[model samples]
Target chain A: MRIVLIFALLFAPPLNTKLGAQQKPAPLEEVKVVATTVLLGQLVQTIGGDAVDVDVLVKAGHDPHRVLPKASMLLRLKNADALIMMGLDYEHAFLPALLEKSRNKNLQDGGNGYENVGKRIAALEVPKSLDRSQGADLHPRGNPHYDLDPENVRIMAMAVREMLQKVDPGRSAQYQLRWTEWDQAAKQEIAIWKAYLKPIAGRNLIAYHNSWPYFAAAFQFKIAGFVEPKPGLRPSPRHLAELEKTMQQADVKVLLMESWVARSEASGLVKRSGCKAIIAPLLGASKQNRSYLTSMQALIEMVGVAHGLPTIQEFKRDAKEEQ
Target chain B: MMAPALLAQQDGMSQGAERRFDPAWNPAIGVALDAFGMMVGGGDGNNEANDSITLRSMELSLSSRIDPLAWAYTSIEFGRHEGAYEVELAEAAIWADQLPHSFSLRTGRYLADFGKWNTVHMHDRPHPFAQGVRQEFIGGSLAMDGVELHHWLGIGDLPVRWSVGVGANFAGHGHSLLAAESDEDLSLGHAHGANFATTSAGDFGLPGFAWTGRVSAQHDVGDNGYFQWGASAFLTAAGLSQEHDAGATTELFELGQNTLAIDLTWHRLAATDSSSDTIGTEFFWNQRDAVDETFDRVERLQAVGLWGFYLHEFNAHIGAGVEGAWWEHADKDDGGHWLSGAEAGRQVAIFAAWKPTEVQRLRLILAMNQPDPAAAADSILAVQWSATIGSHSHSLDW
Candidate 1:
């Protein structure tokens, strides 16, 4: 009898109690939280400390805008006590469908548990109007890319901390403490990155999309133009011709093409303009990249290379003359 | 991850059922409501009054995962058609799961895989509606009834999916309410057949059924993204002649003819978690071989187009971008009934969309569309306020 029991225990299934004991239950004190991006997910994980379970929907290196919400995301939203999202239509295509199909009131807009993190952060590229016909596709309210800058991230962390504490009042102090630590870390990193980018400061660059306003502001990079004539619209021959003329007039060299955009088109523009186009990580490190810090480091290095600065050296170096 | 988890749970149930005879059917149902409106008044003349308002198009679908390898889905839709109540076949099809060697079969009246726009309808499509190019070229107003066989091949980093299909019976035949008759109106191209087609004056030989064959391929390129290309050939032998009792000598005449068309699109979604840039272009060439010289003649259509969009997150809350497009179609020779002309135009739009929650978006867009003389012929300045209630992936795909 004893032998049979031992065999059954060994081969039948993992005992729930044993599994529980080996893998400590994420402490009840920490509330589980979910985010749609790795950067935001990591940021939440840091500030919430042991009190939050941060889940990221889009893995690293993927475009959030194009993400097709999977059926599994419905379950995630349903089970989540509160839902946080980037406010702009960045996740427009898939997120609304996921929320409606999930039927999770907690994640829906206007619900007590729902929050738009962008509302708490500063925005860029505010157009005078929402009209898209004139120049290129423009964001009317402003640029939706506030998270690319570290300072804006601080604002988001505070919002997350406030919301978590509001939902789980008992853990208010813990949330506050973690928020302090995260803010300090973020500020420190921002200062470091700024100092690192000081040499390449004030350089004019062209971006394929209007994604780097905050990053550009922090690093002092001026935007010469974008490759796309408008948002969601492909570049037309006439548009490209006009842009090439503008590039020639502007003397822009570095093309800040995101890893998500097709490189062939950008490379073609580069070939035509004699500019160096480099693929920069649009979203910081993902599961593949391990952590947000590493992703940021990678981004800095990529930007440095584009600027013709020393490659990955611990010490900062001045930008080289235009190659 | 969810599929596996569900499968494991099912295994437990199956084990429990092994001791008893169990008969069962699992069913799934979904309902959706869409609001739509059309502004028709401001055209050439006030003759066409502007009738616009938010109206509903409701649909319901029933589905069953018949077994581990088979499934079926059907839906019924009710809505207004040209200002009248209508009920139509929204969807009806049975799909075979992964058969031996990654093969599958589907039959019944379903969408014919044409361009990226044909696969998904207006409500389910990523954008607010089909682009003008799709509406004009692929006839977004069209659907097919038939069978489809598809297969997927895994080749290293790229997964290629292909499909072959045949369909029949097209709806909606409208002609220029403004244009008059000419020799160009005779045996027309399939695209224009819905609008007008010539008939034999005297009783003679009649045409047979129209048949179409399609081929499509999609290739995923590592982390960069994926691209898809497809083409279709439709044929209706010379016997494809119809008769009209409009004071003519013959009851029917032989109208032997052939029509052919092709299209392609590429989608490179943003990397794992960021908003990626997407660019897509399509070229369509259509031909209608001349039937009996006695039969009136119509010309072919050649169209080429390109559309691109860019999205970047300012932060989790705010992001903005733009999209622009251009399309041009070549004219054909209609045998003396009328004149054929080519039309080319462009559109540009800039938009800002706000997502207060993951599932809700309040977007304001400004757009300008130029028209072709053969088409609408009037430029449009459009300001749109669109709020989406459900999740529809915005990735560029059919």
Candidate 2:
């Protein structure tokens, strides 16, 4: 009798009904999208509006490369209508395991609702060889921080709108209209930022990681050096000494650092190089600046003001008056 | 910059055929090499090799995504048992995630998802020693040749996962280290072949599968800290214990066993990479029908064990820890009441490790062991070198 009961439990409805998988997923009232980051989620929110419910997988101040797959993350992915991700191995460490374990099929690669936003945008620092003789190389495909560039943001936003249309086509017109408006406003903001950032456009700045290349390319600034000798590796003392010498010899007087990166990580370099450090958000990190557009504006103004330049708000006001 | 995007997108599409067959998309090959050297001072002659070197324990593992619906993992282990070495298919499992209600089904031959310790491989253990109670009760670790279903749910910020497994190993058979050894006459986790005088009765075999259940919960104390607690239960036929008078069997009894365990772990990561402190504790209580052949008594034997460890990683390259274990022999028969000189014994070890990289580790351990409570403690010094090359993956162990 006990053996019979054990076999009965093994083949219970919840465990066996979907052995091969549900032929058709139950209809969702709203497209439940799981975005890999807050920045991507904000894009889905802006373009998707009320037609979609977006769940951010990686939380604020968390590193995507070091994500520890947890149960809460799995629960969210189990029923997701779609998945938005920054490809190029941004979610490499954790996404594969979680996605395979998740019940949601739409989020899988090649699925209609699966979107890799980074692929549509430009990539930088594509490695010529996959060599580990130097140190830990987290970014093997290319730099995944293309969202740092506003033009790339446009490409990613376009992707979010298209993915939503594919998953929840009833709201296609609503998404397309919002994306058009978003692109226009983003253009205006980028114009204002460029005008104010023109002074430092050709100047060189030291960065903490390889995260700022897209931002540098967009704004026409040159990255003089980095605190970390290699990507994902801590800055050694000897490397810091060499970086300081480069900063002094090259007359690079500004250092750009991301918030959430321990300032202590770059403190030694900051002291030796005598460069003014400007800490900026890594997009949609705070509740107040969760929107990509607002975070970009805040990031530009913080860097400009720190370098003794006037705020871009004045140029934004001027542009509004001209419009 | 815009040119790179356009050129890369075009190049990417052209390389689509090549990408499909890329080695990166296929199963990852991983190999682990483990070697240990031990020097013992004194013991009750329990271990055959008091001063010896073992280089046989090695593992090769493969893992990759099968498709959008599943992921798979398998491991081949080469290990030692009683001065002899053999290769064992330690684990082979396919995880199907596209089930209903957030339930994941894992089917294959794999570690029993019971408490924490059973799933840990010998190479992954904190110290190089036989687990006391677990060795006596289950084996080195428990392996199940069957299916396990797992479900994850959350209560606010706390996350919990539960797993239930049914397998033949649960039915007192298989080569899982914790399954002890393939079968009754073959291997026991730490075989006490001398205790049971009667051979297993051919007609006494039970046909039911073994059952295993586990519930684990996790709480994030802070950004850098994690806490986990869990409980597990295992029910199975524990083989036979018979009463024999002057080498003639008088009564035969089937040993049915019920085992319960609880575990706790706390890990705190320092800001620096690979620098952290972790403490874990596990306790087990097991009950089984047994015949104290010495006393000619048939009764339910109750046994217990406690094991704990504290590991501190000083940097990316170095770590140290202390592990201590205490267990009461399953036969019970304590001093004065039953047939016993002593019922409980303890082992403690202090170890230090150097990890050149994530895949490489070399460690040295100094241990004081009381194989028998009535015997004086023995001290042993050991050194181990373990390394994993190629693809390596594991849970965060939070």
Candidate 3:
């Protein structure tokens, strides 16, 4: 009997193994994925777990506004079963040509295969009037930069899950299961970030572009002003001088600039204002050996470090010192 | 201006000459009849009526797409003052291949690429609209018979696009000529003099030739939904002229003139779920070179204009929004005593449009334009109904 048991163990389980090895209800079909950036790639993967193949055209740390299509990039767009775009004219310069070349006319306007992530989230910088000349330049249809807000990311993820369900009805239940876990984790992380930010919520900061409105609104941070008076128009010496004077009055301690803008200008402002400058990633950044989550955590950690407050490192040091 | 053609022909067609048919070919038949009535209000000196309405602009055209690459675009227009019909856009040409950068070349009687707004000729318009100072200062804003080579390039991974064109006109520009001391305004406020007559036709009287070149660049960003920012510059010059009219006195002055214009436009298109926006700001300046053998100084006209619009579209079916235009010309003060009557205006317009479908659009626009209240006083309430029967890319008129 002992010899028989050893033989059975060497081969497989007696009953459960035989049933389990027979077949999967069916081999799970590969899930179709369409993403605008690498951050979405990570998020979808974390939730999708494995049964999917995701393709993102835009890399992290790249300016979505200026992303043009290469010949190779066109081939990738053509093969995608679905397409996800930031929408709200953020990628206007490139998306039109890409769609035309892909011969994907269905994705042009109201195609079912096309998904606009901005539609699911609220926008900032919405102008009161439709006039383009009302103070340099302003977005008449709210701000399209909702991606900066962590809460909005959750909303976007939910929309993505819904779209994925439509794309793969067979794995709808599995996708929901994974979505719940990922969304709950995201909500918990957001709460932790909110609490972490509570100490310096009212701090004043200056921005390079108008990209920070959504983030400022979420955290109750006051935006002192912008480096460029108008979008796309370079700030004249006179304008920069005026901005310096305003910065002194506002007592802005931090100069927040987008990574895409030339650092020399922000450096000039930092030198003139005698303030700490932070080159923050305006979009989902893909740093070497780091994901979007880690990049965002690094940014928040830097903010705490810039304030000269108790960083997580500092806290750990203090605890050891107390010990 | 004809020198480029001769040069190109001499350059040897065997170099890279490929025989290809134009993609923009259309053989369609159309019939249109238009009648307009305008009211004149408050004229003091030599006015016929205090308030009267009359036919303003009416026209009919027979457009023919002769071949794959060539077209025969002909139109006849009737004016209110002259009360006579004349051929307006009687020309033919071909649109060549578009480059990968979205730039294309054309050899035809098309309008000279000048102002952002003037590229669309009046005869092509479904209704009559007033041209701005930049358009008015530049001759007819119409095409000179010539061949133009154009291209677009980006600025080092930025969202900026540069459009450049080099070409020559079949006829010289006439509006740049200055009036002589003997010139007088006729009863119709029309300057009947050597300047107007010679400039309208040119010294050869066959309309002299002119050399033209222009460079325009626009950088757009997500300034707003259905709105973006853009700026462009254009330059045109009447090159050396050989033919001179001995009988006409104004033709005796051979001064090559060049005009330059720069402007910004903010444009936006929105739908319920999606939106597109572009904002552009422009500055324009024109200079008249004194090719005159006489003691005339080079004159210049400088004007600044800001034009932009924001549109909130529920969908392609329905949308509403507002647009604004503000223009001011540089002050001109010479020894001459009569007021130049240079125009400046600020206009704010609210408009609503209904698109029954993708191809048909009905728009209602109401604008209050204050055009040089001191010099000329007139406010217009214009409504337009625009529609298309076919694809946009296939039509040259848009």
Each candidate's chain B TM-score? Answer: 0.65, 0.80, 0.58
**For each candidate, what TM-score against the reference?**
0.46, 0.76, 0.44
Candidate 2 CA-lDDT value: 0.72
lDDT digits (tens) for residues A142-224 of candidate 2: 88888888888889889998998888766777888999999899887787778889877787888987789999999998898
TM-score of chain A of 2: 0.86
Could you give candidate 3's per-residue lDDT for residues A113-209 as a string of tens digits? 5778877766776666664233323445677778778888787777777766666666777878988987888787677667667788888888887
Expressed as tens digits, the lDDT of each residue in B117-144 for candidate 2 is 7777767776555465566566546666
- lDDT values of the candidates? 0.55, 0.72, 0.51
Which window of ten consecutive residues has the lowest lDDT sum in model 2 chain B? Answer: B178-187
> Judged by DockQ, which candidate is best?
2
Residue B187 accuracy (lDDT) in model 3? 17
TM-score of 2: 0.76
Q: Model 3, stretches more than 4 Å misplaced?
A: A1-32, A132-138, A282-289, A313-323, B1-398
- lDDT of each residue in B17-78, candidate 1, tens digit only: 35454466557665555553333322254423323444334556677767756777876666
Candidate No. with top lDDT: 2
